[model samples]
Target: MVENSNLLAEQRRALILDEVRRRGGVRVNELTRRLNVSDMTVRRDLDALARQGVVEKVHGGAVPVMEASTHEPGFEAKSGLELTAKEDIAREAARLVAPGSAIALSGGTTTFALAQHLVGVEGLTVVTNSVRVADVFENAARGGSAASPAATVVLTGGVRTPSDALVGPIADRAIRSLHFDLLFLGCHGLSVEAGLSTPNLAEAETNRTFVASARRVVAVADHTKWGTVGLSTFARLSEVDTLVTDSGLPAEAREELAEHLRSVLVAGAEGPATSG
Candidate 1:
């Protein structure tokens, strides 16, 4: 009986993720009626998800965590928001790339921007789940801009999320067999407490695999992500080897991050740049 109850709870939580994905938010009353569960049960489930950083509990319902802080905007939308900031962060990230190295690039606007700078890097192998990032490398190959031997790019196969990340079991399975010299990851939110997080649960799960596969982890995010807390925590602040962010990060926050992370690279002056 206990096992069956646990199964049911897991099933219900999966449904809740689906519902929230489809509707953007879910009212407790509606969930209670739809799941045929009591109001207390629905609240309990929401509470559980909240603890995992998957959803934000509202006054009477729950909203997707992406919507909580700047809404983890789409690729194009996010790309435009922090152009200069991302460029600076990307440039700094590119500096970390070594020739003849294997690396994983997780999907996010900042990482995508970093892909732009990596085009000329020689003998690099890139494993990524972002269609856009792969396209950049592919186009660069076709353009033939002197990346002698060219960069090898691997695209992960999986369900695409709102943030344009390919995730789920297929992506997870693909990453498990590989090891990387570095993993340049992007996150929707970052904090001293919650660590690195994203709004999508599957993306978060896949990101954890990226963390496990890489010898070093470098986070590329702008200052805007400082206080935002997403629905899922993929890694803690201490787990990251380096943080490449813009000057916009408050002094206090930078001091805090510097204390935990192995190194923190600040980009240009703290204004007019966008980040994920």
Candidate 2:
């Protein structure tokens, strides 16, 4: 009877996942009614799927994971998904920046979070393809923040992606003409095989140019991004100087990443731990 009950639960969760994929997103109440299960049970099922990284649990429901190679979610859609993890990563990545240095930031929620931390850093010059990231500094300056005067922000001009990233020939030329002390890149996916990837092909090209222009590269991503490959790959794992991720990543996975990456910083309550 126990085995039978477990089998039923598995089947039910599978159905829920299918429903989420079909609809793009589904509320808990709707899932409960469709599956004929109690709200508690549906919530538990959503939690399980979220743990597997196959779906993302939202306010009262879940949405399909953007695991498809070509899948791309807009900036706002991604902003609320990994708030804590992104903040942790941003804090750690910020430590790598120095005053009076030119750095490049790529588009993605994680990089956007990092931009906030950098607002107070004195004498910093930032070049980015992300309109959202550029806005962080621009807004700070307008707000009369004393530290804003120490920062210079440059927004690349080009076609924009769903993530509010400027990409294409214009962005590419601008990046190639300049040099950066470091680059903080955010990706849709990361893995030993695919490395850093994005759903947009033009963004991939622009990211490649960013990598080439920088003396060092730091990839900032939460654990959920692991094993998720996007349509286009920008840089190999070997190309990154450091990887900063949240503690939600499994131990085994961190071990594997440390083998390819020069350094892996796992951010947690205690602080970021380094492995390489």
Candidate 3:
């Protein structure tokens, strides 16, 4: 009986997830009627999904995790998204780094792309909360770049989330003690009102520490992220020294962002040479 019940529960949850994905979000009452289950059962199913980072439970129902900034996609799921824009943004972000600069990178596909570009840069002291980003540099250092100045990679110890970001008191404490010349920040969403935001609450808190630790904060995001508000705000537009995004950003929105940031760098699809 126990095994059969468990199988039924799993089946129900799958249906709920499918419904949520199809409709973007679903109300609890609607789910109860469709599933022919009590409100409590529906809530229980939603709670389970929430724990897996599959769906974010709101007041009445649940929404697809990817639709809101409060729920983040896994690292692999996000990697394939916005590839062209991320590569262009990464190329431009690389131009801002000088040799031997101490830099901090917050986790996101955009920042990871930046990491790939920076592997060839000599003499970098990198501090990060991303395991993948550190691994990228670590692999590059093995039997590679013999003549290039050795880059120091610092990986923080903390609880890893679905986004593969290390966060918690451990990461926060480490960031407080060190300072960096620049911070290459990435986010789930960006808005003039929300500033730089992320869906995961812990990531938001850790990113705040990253903001405080860096002299210059450069945010790298794609155009699709504009105006999308996440659950937590890490830094305001005023806190960022520069905003780097692709030219896919609307002109009017660019004008609005220019009002808040020190500088806005638009990387064209043509690549770094064309972007100023």
Q: What's the true lDDT of residue 51 in model 1?
A: 67
Model 2: clashing residue pairs? Answer: none
lDDT of 3 by residue, 86-149 (tens): 8889999999999989999999889999999998888899999999899889888884866875
**Candidate 1, overall lDDT?**
0.82
Better of 1 and 2 by TM-score: 2
lDDT of 3: 0.83
Worst 10 residues of 1 by lDDT: 1-10
For every candidate structure, what is the RMSD over all alpha carbons to the true structure, in angstroms? 14.0, 7.5, 11.8
Would you list the rank order by lDDT, best first?
2, 3, 1
**What lDDT score is found at residue 258 in candidate 3?**
88
lDDT of each: 0.82, 0.86, 0.83
For model 2, how does the per-residue alpha-carbon lDDT over 113-198 read when each residue is reduced to its tens digit?
99999988889999999999999988888886653574788899999899999999999999999999999999998888999998
- Candidate 2 global lDDT: 0.86
Q: For each candidate, what TM-score against the reference? A: 0.72, 0.80, 0.74
Candidate 2 segments exceeding 4 Å error: 1-45, 48-53, 56-67, 145-148
- Candidate 3 positional error at 218, Å: 0.2
lDDT of 1 at 7: 31
